[model samples]
Target: MRKLILLITLTLSGTLAVGQTTQKPPLHGKHWMAITGKPLAATAGSMIFNKGGNAVDAACGILAANCTMWDVLSWGGETQALIYNPKTKKVIAINAMGVAPTGATPEFFKEKDMAYPPEFGPLAATTPGTPGGLMTMLAEYGTLSLAEVLAPAMEMAKGYPIEAQTATIIENQKHLIKEWPYSKKVFLPHLGEEREAPYPGEVFVQEDLFQTLKKLVDAEKEALAQGKNRKEAIYAAYARFYTGDIAEEIVRGTREQGGLFTMEDLAKWKVKIEEPLQVNYRGIDVYKLQEWTQGPAMLQSLNILENFDLKSMGYNSANYIHTVYQAMNLAFADRDFYYGDPAFEPKSPMKGLLSKEYARERAKLIKPINDPEIGPGDPYPFQGEKNPFLHLLEKQNEVIAYNNHGTAILGPDDPFLESFLAGTTSIQTADAEGWVVSVTPSGGWVPATIAGNTGVGLSQRMQSFVLDEKLNPFNVLEPGKRPRVTLTPSMALKDGKPYFSFAVQAGDTQDQNLLQMFLNVVEFDMTVQEAAEAANFNSYQMQSSFGAHESKPGAITLNTQIPSWIRGDLKKRGYKMDFLERTSGPLNAIWFDWKHGTFWGGSSNHGEDYGIAW
Candidate 1:
C-alpha cells in the first residue's frame, strides 16, 4: 500500500508538471486508466482498475473519493454521468440531478421578497441525488461490491492530508461555515475556539462522515446476508441512505432549520437513465444530456459551426473565435429560454433544437461584427408548437446588465472561480475490455451549507430554479422537477465505437470547453494533452445559469496564451474581451486508440487535476 501511494504521488507530480507550459506528453497505457481533479481521488479510481474492476466500478470509487477529498464535490450533491457499454454498443445518460421539494414554490420565496432561493442555507437544499446515482450505477453497470468501492473514500474521510486547493476553499468559506455549528464542526479547526481553517498538509478528518459511509457498507452486508445478489445489495445500500435512518436524520435537520425538504422527497427521489442526445461533426458523434442540462447548447453550437470551414479561419483567429462565440451565444440564448425539465413539459422542443436545419437557420444570423443581443431561435416553428418564451426573447440595443450581487463570483483574488474553473472532479475510465465511463459528480461545496450532524451536506442547486412562474413554465419552481443544470459530461463515438470521453466543471463554460477541446483534437489534430493545454476562450454573452440569471452580452474571456494580436483583432471586431491567467475551465479526457490498443489520458493544469494511466 505504501509503495502504491508513493508511486501515485510521483506519477501525479509528473502529471501536474505537464499542466504547465512545458508541453509534457500525455500519459500512455495499454490496459486501463483514470483521471480526476484530485490526485488521491484518481489514485482511488486507479486502484479499482488495478483490482480488475471495470470502468463503472472505477468511477464509483472515483466519485466516492472525490466527495471526501474535494469540498466542491459533496456526498449530498448531484451527479450527471454518461456511460458507454461496449458489450451493448450503446451510450446511456444518467440524470442524477436532485428535484425541488414539494414545498418549493414561487409564493414561498415571493413572501420573503426574494427572486430565488437562498444561495447558502437550508432553504437552498434539495433531495440529494449523488448517493442514489452512484448506487444505481454500481447495481446496473459495475462488478464490484459497495464495500469494496467505498473503502478508499471511507479511508479518506478518516484522515487525509488536505490539498492546497481544498484548504483555500475552506478558508474562503469559513464565514459561511461559522454560521452553522455542525458545518463548523466538520470543516474548521478547533471547533469552538479560534476557528482556523485547515491548511495544506494538515490532516483533516470527518469522523461523522466516515461513520455515515460505514453504515452504507454495513447495510450492503446485511442485504447480502439476506440472500440478495450484488445488485440487490447495492440497491439495499441506497435504501439505507434514501429511506432509512439517514433520511430520517436529514428530514429532522432540514425541518428543524426551517427548510422544505421532507422524508417523502428523499424516499421518492430516483436517478433517471435516459437516451443521450448526439450530433455528428466531422464523422464523430458528440453526445450530451437532453433538456435538463446545458449540454444541448454545445450540440447546437457545433451544428451551426459545422457549416463553416473553421480550419480555414485558422485556430484562435478572430474569425474563428467570433463565429464560435456567436454560435454559442445563440445556443445559450435558446438554452435559457427553452431548455428545462422535460418531465414537466414532455413536449420540449429538443428534436427541433438539435436538428441540422435549425442550426443552419440560426447560423444565418451570425455576422462579421459581434451581435450583442442574439436571442433564442424559433424552435417551436420547427417543432410544430408555439414558443412560450418568445415574448421574453426581446433584443436590446445596450449590453445586458450584469447583476453580480448574488452570484458565486467571490472576487478577482478569490479562488472560488479558479476552483470551479480548475474544473469539478471529472472521472473517466476505460478498461481493457472497452467499457468506458465519463462521470461528472459535483455539488455540496462552499455555497451549500452543511446539514446538521447527519454527516451530510446539501446542494445549493435550487439557485438554478427561477422564482418567476411567467419566465418559462419549464424552469419555474415546481415540486418534483429537476432544475436545468450546467453539469454536463460528454462522449464521442467513431465508427460505432467509443473514441473519447471528456467533461469540464465551470458552470456556463462546461459545454463550451467541451466543444473547444473536441474540435482541438478532431479538427485541429492535437493530442489529448495538447488540446487541454492549448489556449482557450469562453463567452458570457448569454445569461448565466446560476444565481440571478444575469447576462453580459458580448463578454468574452481569453487565456493569456492567446497571442496579443488575436486579442487586439477580436477587440477591433466589437467583441468584449478580458484576459485570464489560464484556461477558463479545466478539461479532463481519455482517448482510446482501439486499433493500437492504447489509452491516452490528459487533464488541465489549471487546478489540482491529474491523470494516471497504467
Candidate 2:
C-alpha cells in the first residue's frame, strides 16, 4: 500500500528515474558492482570487471574514464581513496593529492593582492596527481595490463558522443577556456559558430589527448619489450608522465600561462599508501582519510552522536535534526583550525581531535540556539600536551569577522551559492571477493587551463589554502605542502568484515550529509538506497573552503518536506532557515551482504550517478 502511494506520487510527475526505490531501484549484484558519477564511467568499470579484473582494477578503469570524459575532473586533478584489502583484512588509505609548487607561499599570493589563491588559471594549479594515483593503484593490485585498463578512456579520447552536461559546461566556460591557448584549441573546436561547443550527441574528439595517452601506452609496451614485469612496466609509464617528454610539455605549457609548476615539483611528488583513520560507532567501524582531508570531521561527528540514543530520537525529527547539526558544526569548527598535512611540522592534534572524550567536551558547548561564535577547542590537552596555538585560537572569530568583509554572501537558492559547492564525484566499487574501494577524486573541472600540448588539465586545488595564519596556522600554504581539502571517501566494517563503501561530492557539506546517511542506515535500519536518497540538511555555519572562504552563522538549508511544525521548532531554536526540494546528496554506496554473499548497490537519482551489476 505504501509502495502504491509512492508509485502514484512519482508517476504523476513524469517518467520514473528509470527504476525506483527512491527513483532508482536497489541493484543486487551476485558477482560485482561498479558505480560512479556518470553512467559511461560506470560502464567502464563494468567492462573491466567483466574482463576478470578485481575491484581495484575496475576502480582504476572508472577513474580513467571519468578523467577522459571530464565529469568534474581531469587527468591533472587529485585522488584520495580507501580500499579494503580482502587478503590483509585491513583498510588502506591512498593519498595522491598534489602539493604546492616551489614558489607557492602565503607571501606569494598576498603579493598579488589576494587573501587566498585565485579560482582559475595557471596560478591556481597544483602538481598533477590523478595519473600517478591511477597507475599506482592498478600496478599494485590489479591483474590486467595498463593497456587493458585504459582501453575505455583511450577510445573515449579518440572520439565519443558528448553528453549535454559536459557540452554545456564547455560552451558556458568557453570565454575562460579561450584564455589558455591550449585549452582554447582543445575545448572550442567551432569557435565562431552559433554553438561553439559540440552538440549533445556530437562526437567530441581530443586528438592531442589521444596522443598523450598513446605515449604512456607506448612507454609501457617498450618497457615490456625490454623484459620488465607488469608492475615495473606500469611504473615505467608512470615515470614517462612525471619525468619524461610528457612532464616537459606540461611544465612548458604551465610556465607559458604563468603557472608555478616546475620539473622538480612534478618529479618529487609521489603517491602515499598509509593507514586510514577509524572510529567505532556502535559496532560498526567507520574509516576515513587522515587529517590532510576533512574526512576526520565525519569520524568526530559519529563520536559525539554515539553519546545519544539516536534511534530513540527518530529519523529527521526536530530533535534528531538539531543534534546532528550541532555535532557537524562542532566537528567542522575543529576541522577548520586543526586539519592539515601530517607530513609537515607542528603536527595537528589528530590524537586529541579524534578523541571521544574531546568530542564529549565539545558537545557540552552546544546550546538551544546556534552559537555563531563557536571557535576551535583545545584538543592538545586531550592528547596530554599543552595547546601550542592557543593564542591563535582565541582570536579566530575576530579573524573571521575581518575576512567576512571580503567574502561574498549569497542566498541558498542562488546558482552561485558561496559555500558547500565543489566540482567533484564519488567512485564506489565492490566485488564478490570482498575487495572494496571508495574514492572522492576531484579538481580540474571545466574552465580548467590545459597544460601545453599534453591535454592534461591543471588542478585548481591551490585555492583551498589560506594565506593567513590567523585563519588556519596548520594550513597556511608553503612550498610542497598540501592544503587541507574537503574531499573524503568512506568505508565501514561490521564484525571485522567489509560492510559498506560510500562517498559523495559536496565540498564542505560532504561530511554533514555522510554523517546523517550513516545514522539513517545504522540507527533507522534503512536500506542502502533509502539512506542514500534520504533528504539530509546542510548547515552553512562553517567557513567555505573555496572562493572567499566565508562563513554564514546560524544559516540552515532544509528539505521542503519537513513539516511546518518542525520548521517552526527549528525557527524557535534560533535557526535561520531556507528550503529546497533536494537539499542534499549525489551519494553513492555499496553494501556488502555478508550473510547472503552478495552486494547491494545504490546510486542516487539526485545526480547523473549510475550503477551496473550482474
Stretches of candidate 2 exceeding 4 Å from the true structure: 1-21, 400-419
How much RMSD separates candidate 1 from the native structure?
4.7
Q: Candidate 2: lDDT over CA atoms?
A: 0.89
Model 2 agreement with the true structure over 427-546: per-residue lDDT tens digits:
999887878999999988898999999889999999999888878888999889988999999999999998888999988888988888888889998889988888899887788888
Model 1, 1-614: lDDT tens digits are 99878777966877444244434567788888888888898899989887778989999999999888864778888998999987899999999999999789989888999888776788887789899999999999999999999999999889999988778778877878777777778888755556377878999998988988999999999999999999999999899999998888778877777778888999988999999999998799989987888899999999999999999998888889998888898898788777889888644699889999999999999988887766667887777778765555552222243222233223456343343343456888888888888988777876456666676888878878887644445688888989888889999999998898998777778888888988889889888888887778877666666666666566677877788788888888776666778773678899888779899887876666777888
User: Can you tell me which runs of candidate 1 are displaced by over 4 Å?
Assistant: 1-24, 192-195, 394-423
TM-score of each: 0.93, 0.96
Model 1, residue 278: C-alpha shift (Å): 1.0
Per-model tally of clashing residue pairs: 0, 0
Worst 10 residues of 1 by lDDT: 396-405
Ten-residue segment with the worst summed lDDT in candidate 2?
401-410
lDDT of 1: 0.81
